[model samples]
Target chain A: MTSDHDTPARPAGLPPYAIARQGRRARYDAASVHAILDAGLVAHVGFVADGRPMVIPMAYGRDGDTLFIHGATTTRIIRGVAEDVAEDVAKDVQVCLTVTLIDGIVAARSAFHHSVNYRSVVVHGAARHVTDPAEHDHALRVITEHLLPGRWDEVRPMLAKERKATGVLAVRIAAASAKIRTGGPVDDDADYALPVWAGVLPVTTAIGRPIDDGRVAEDTPPPPSLAAARRKFA
Target chain B: MTSDHDTPARPAGLPPYAIARQGRRARYDAASVHAILDAGLVAHVGFVADGRPMVIPMAYGRDGDTLFIHGATTTRIIRGVAEDVAEDVAKDVQVCLTVTLIDGIVAARSAFHHSVNYRSVVVHGAARHVTDPAEHDHALRVITEHLLPGRWDEVRPMLAKERKATGVLAVRIAAASAKIRTGGPVDDDADYALPVWAGVLPVTTAIGRPIDDGRVAEDTPPPPSLAAARRKFA
Candidate 1:
């Protein structure tokens, strides 16, 4: 039931469905997948709800092979993983989590060749409902720190009420792939000689100077954690 | 069967399932949804693939209420829109297209309340396999122009062979919602008085100076289309 009905030509270790027949730029190695996931800030988490598919932006954190996402226990995903195709399956709700970082815009001589320079990872796995307090606390910290590294330690600890209200879902990377495109566009060989100008317009996510809230002292500078995040993003 | 099990308290015009119960920030108006979609560069498209959900980042273009995504004719959603719940449904394929723009990082005093400032649009609808030649060509142009406003006129027109090889899928947004969060961190009243500095670190996608490909003349300046895109992105 994988997306591709063609011959199974995927590299070793990946599940058949994660074979990545969607495009020509797929890379199946874990290094590429982890790197893209670690660098990404938001994940487009797709899950079924009421027989229809829904994709939403969510902040995620990576712990080894597992990806963590949290929200109110009442949310569609947190409440249930959606109906599984089979009752015998381990988990009813499955998820497709995708992360992408657009590196640049490839402007080619031909419109057909125009493409984006990007690095992305797509993960398919079961949505494990996390209830263990220790695991839930760790997942929250991981998610918080993933965005602003050391900011988690500087911030107040999670209160009991806060922990109770939050629900965590873990998706183990059962199958995944990273697809990347870089450098210049590959134009039609004949069009490469055309008068049109072609090259890469690099697109990057830039972290700007931090603006402090009014309540903080005028002289109070950004903390070390913020500085660390600044360095990483810069 | 929409995702939410809550009362249909949605504003007029939107379907019950399109209601945003995911978080506190939700905007159902077309203006907000279109604005976010227009500014976005990549869309994470989710559809049922082999009984499980799959989400992949795609470059998309908007034409009024329809979102167009093109790929090889054999791709999952391009060939057919996943499965429809009922046998008698008009089209068997349903898709969820989502676009997100990260505006900033909210640095809150409590880890529990920390969040990202972003604008996102999610659309759920039936995926129509586009085959009409004129609409197909126009959809491609719309997609190109959406990314680089005037690049279509500058680049060589898409060739007949290119069109033959490509497949376009249009999703007339059945139900959509936009969510936006902005400004500095909203900390607890007591924590706002804490000595810790709190602020927002603005996150932005920066388009850098365009570099010409080797084939172009050294003095050949970037075309007007690229300049227009730079102005828009800048």
Candidate 2:
């Protein structure tokens, strides 16, 4: 069943990452891609508008190999894409989606050789509008649940009018690659005694105590799943 | 004296965030521009290649609103920019630079209404070539030390030939904006009893103990600045 949802399978290894990817390539598997996407909460989205490459930072969610993004209907770029598609215009729309987790900092003996330890996934594809209401609803759910687990069950469903007003699109993960760097810094032999501090400053994401909205009467405690996740991170 | 060196002369009310700058439709002030560049460790660089917008991740540093990025000299994008400048020609170049910090996740009563609290800066600019040797060297130092903190004082400096072989360009930050989204999720009054979890999953960058390179001589200890920073984070 899950395989049915797998990103339109790419010709094996069609979009190999550049030298940077080769030098720090991760295990390119479905699990790896999903894990990286799941661990990430924000994505830097890039697209061309007015023939200029523009990047916007936004919240995103992923299911299988498909990534879902949405924003205000007033967002200029989003409107442009929708208008172009509504006109049945065959527009060449290229979108690049990327997520990065800076696991640590690699300090090398030589300043010239310092590097960051990170896991990043870069996806390149032609973005198109999702016109079908059911599919659009599902995509929005994927996005919502990605940010807050079990959220789709708790919130009021999207109304027809509101859904129409929000411009949401689905970018099928087509050409993609995962690049990762880990472990300690690589230093030159001669520079070993240069007396520079060289090591990995590991970074992690942690959650804090939950603060209830003042509107909640009696300050209701957080939900079970939300409370459990917070404890795990804490 | 320390304030003068510790903090750049930041302009008053200059929004230091790129996304906030964009949302407010603010202009690029020198101090706001510098702070965004200096505080960032890397940038998502986008450009048109083969009539497609390609977003590449890279490390960058800033001197004022002018940003410097480095890569292999033989790279196609770098070569193209250099040729255009060497011939005193103008080419279509569109780039976006963004820096973002994810503070927390805002979970609303309704799943469709989830959001994130973040601060981001975006720069829309035409990236040009930097061919001057003196300027390139200065940019390299800024980029290197910006990421590694105090490593410049410990590592062997770059050589003249090495610097020439590496492609470095300083692109001015122009037409920038900083848009910000903060606070908890906003949900409709009717949706409060949905029985779904609704609270922010606060995200923080936690730096952990430094892991020394195994090859380092057994007798050596971490430098005071680095060791102390690690302790502080610990």
Candidate 3:
């Protein structure tokens, strides 16, 4: 079902659909793409429904080249894809998933050049529902571990009924691109000479002190895994 | 060009296009929607191109109910909208703009309940290129101040040539919805009795020490605006 225009040659390793608007900032290297995807906690999933575009934020995990996302069976994304599958077995749901991390705010001497230092990854592919029991179980584990390393080992195992209530969508990294903009503002040549102060205020996501759910026993302390996760970010 | 299905009754104060899938979490209040949009520094813009959905990240600003975003004139979004304007003077580009902020990671006793506490705002409407000089100028100011308060006054104003080079698009908040999830994970009753720990790990975006652009004079100190911005986030 793919058209010639949709399947472009992978020049410099970048998939045709994932080309960056800025040639200089485009990164197709697998390592770079994986790093950006791994570092991000949330991804914006884009899909077309009834010719209207919808973007929904969801937590995701990457197992090699496959990106896994799960939700309740009633959710729009899951239900929409399910309906599409039912209509035409040969067609998969087309999606464009994107992850962006804002590194810093660039304050330029003029409003025209104001920008932000950021790293973003865009993935384009067909998302298929993972119905196999083994793959579904593995996808859940990957997702839990992706959010909090060592969490899956400590958490109770998924029950048969619990697994059935959840639906996992796996999107292969068929075409992906990463774009990064760093450093300070690049202003108009004449405006840099102005007396205005211009610099980068670095932005970072920090994990604050953990708050217990109050149900934990008084003797119980923060787990080592939680402490390690905090330190990793710190 | 609005269709009957495209326009729905906003009985809850939410625009038809901005309806939330979860009725309980949906917020149509202007205050709530504005707060989420203002706090976020970037927006994921969803648009359709050639029957495919594309979501691109861009810096944006809000003034009253109108949202402003700018980019190079040659960019797909800008170019696409511009072409639409030329073809029909009465038509505007349809878009869905979304912003999401992840507040915490919710770890449940079982893999099925893992989630993230977040606040997200979705706005759906027609985007028109800002051709009015006064509105365009004000939009730039709002954008600069949105990133860093007290910034527009200190920085040099946009030059005529610089303004000409940029394409600014304004999308009125015709239909908007905000969804927020907070507190700890809501786990299954049986899993809560398990010994596994379950709680929310709070996440915050912090500003690190500012970095000078190297071109600034050595004697120049960090502006009070920068300090104020940091304290506001802190």
How does each model score on TM-score? 0.88, 0.83, 0.89
Worst 10 residues of 3 chain A by lDDT: A1-10
Better of 1 and 2 by lDDT: 1
Candidate 3 lDDT over A30-85, as tens digits, reads 88888888888788887777667777787788999889987777766677777767
* Candidate that beats the other on DockQ, 2 or 3, i.e. the better one: 3
Candidate 1 backbone collisions, by pair:
A81-A93, B81-B93
Off by over 4 Å in 1: A1-23, A81-92, B1-23, B81-92
Per-residue lDDT over B1-234 for candidate 3, one digit per residue giving the tens place of the 0 to 100 score = 000011221332344435434354677678988999988978888777776667778878898898998777766777777777753473577777889988987877777777788888777777888877898788777777777788777778777887887778898877877878899888777776777777888888988888878778666677777887687666
Q: Which candidate comes out best when scored by lDDT? A: 1
TM-score of 3: 0.89
Root-mean-square deviation (CA) per prediction? 4.9, 7.4, 5.2
The CA lDDT of each predicted structure is: 0.76, 0.64, 0.74
Q: Of models 1 and 2, which has the larger TM-score?
A: 1
Q: Pick the candidate with the highest TM-score.
A: 3
lDDT of 1 by residue, B7-121 (tens): 1222324552365554467777788889998889888888876667778777789988888887766666665542322353436477788998988888888987787889888
Evaluated against the true structure, the overall lDDT of model 1 is 0.76
Ranking by DockQ: 1, 3, 2
Per-residue lDDT, model 3, residue B37, is 90
Mind giving the per-residue lDDT tens digits that candidate 2 earns over B120-229? 66676667676677887787777765665555666678867767767776667655655455677778777876555566777777777778887666766776546543
Complex DockQ per candidate: 0.49, 0.34, 0.43
Model 1 has a clash total of 2
